[model samples]
Target: MNSTLPHLGFGTFRLEGQTAFDAVSMALNAGYRHIDTAQIYGNEQAVGDAIQASGVARADLFLTTKVWTEHLSRDAFIPSVKASLAKLSTEYVDLLLVHWPLNHNTVTMEDYLSSLKEAQDMGLARHIGVSNFTVAQTEQAVDILGKRVLLTNQFEVHPYLQNSKVVAKCRELDLIVTGYMPFAYGAVLKDPVIVTIAEKHGATAAQVVLAWMRQQGYVTIPSSTRQVNIDSNLKADSLELDATDLADIAALDRGHRVANPDFAPEWD
Candidate 1:
């Protein structure tokens, strides 16, 4: 399994045009080494531009990008990644992912897994994984890959939507859990429980939530546009949470998912 991925990453979802470049540039300046983006997000060019402008050596960065559902077919998979690498201005991404598990009618699990492995074998991605997959699908993935080829699973996880079921399975398979929308799309920031915990820690609600995820051993990719927010989010790694704090945060789980789309698979 790949180990270059940090516990925290800079997400580029919805960040595009000049906004993506600025946020990514600031994120790099704020000391983030891991950057996450996707072909579906239509911002690989901006991410590439930011990396180029940041002057941070490619060797120092852990770049992650996802192959959209449209490109999961064997024919499209490798070409899609090649396109992404060209757009990112990088020869290879540290990690590549199946953005979502869908359209089973078109691409069988075996086919997609084989294609993803083909990408890895071709040296397009140093490591490969999946996003938004449940335990059953991950099992199928493992069986098809026939090894621990997946390095992590990116999913929507937060205090409101704990996702313990998926987290448990990924842990069982020894795949690191990458929690996207760890803030619950900003809905959890002003939550009463989160507020109370933030007060005790003297940290922002974002920091408290991020710290909880970190303490739980789940990697998070929380996005931000402000420099203060980016810097503060990074500090979440240092904000230690105690048992009581953990329990309080745990009590806030209501399965409040914020990123679900109509095409999303049945969630774990």
Candidate 2:
């Protein structure tokens, strides 16, 4: 499977009701061909409705969704994926991810990884990946699944919480990095440095942050419910920052993390 993904994609995490449908439709109209949704988000049907409403051909888009932690077992994984498919109104997803590493008591890593592989084999998901996994967990996955088809490791990566260790290891192993929470959960927009850079580029702070992530070769899925923000977010692909601009933004790192799950598995 190809490891390189588009630099920018639409994320549907907390969106729901007509808000999600309209936001997704705006994103599609703004030239966003990649959409991210997950079963845990409770908005797959809204996402599916928006996708269909856009009148865009399914083949023209890259759709990704995740299997919830509670559905990590071999038996549960299959039906979970089918249910996700039904909600998304699609037969196969461009990529499907294990939402989180299941706790040891719920299912062993081997069991969950095997179920993910089965989903791939059954043609429910074209490519398989994991989210919120540490570098150690990723290594374990490679050890168990081999090097054939682990396409990506999705996580909360941004200017703050740079995740340098995991990013370097993923690069060493040729695993693509998909960065979630690219804005640092609205903190990036308020940074003076990012604002200055955005002013120079005639782009918004969010656009500059997204561009920065893309320049680092990380696929970013940023969520927005506003039509204007959704449109502006897709423009991240076209904005380019020079070396100095990149350095200024990089200096904003303070190891700030916004999406830490207390009940989640240990991360390095």
TM-score of 1: 0.98
Candidate 1: clashing pairs of residues: none
Q: Which structure among the candidates has the greatest TM-score?
A: 1
In model 2, pairs of residues that clash are none
- Candidate 1: list runs displaced more than 4 Å: 1-3
Give Cα distance to truth, residue 226, candidate 2, Å.
Answer: 1.5
Q: What TM value does model 2 have?
A: 0.96
The residue-by-residue lDDT of candidate 2 on 1-268, one tens digit each, is: 2344666889988899788898899899989988999998999999999999999999899999999988998789889999999989999998999998865666888998898999999999889998888889888988899885788999989887788888987888778999999888799889999999999999999989988988898898999988789888777879999999988877877889888777677766
* For every candidate, C-alpha RMSD to the true structure in Å: 1.3, 1.6
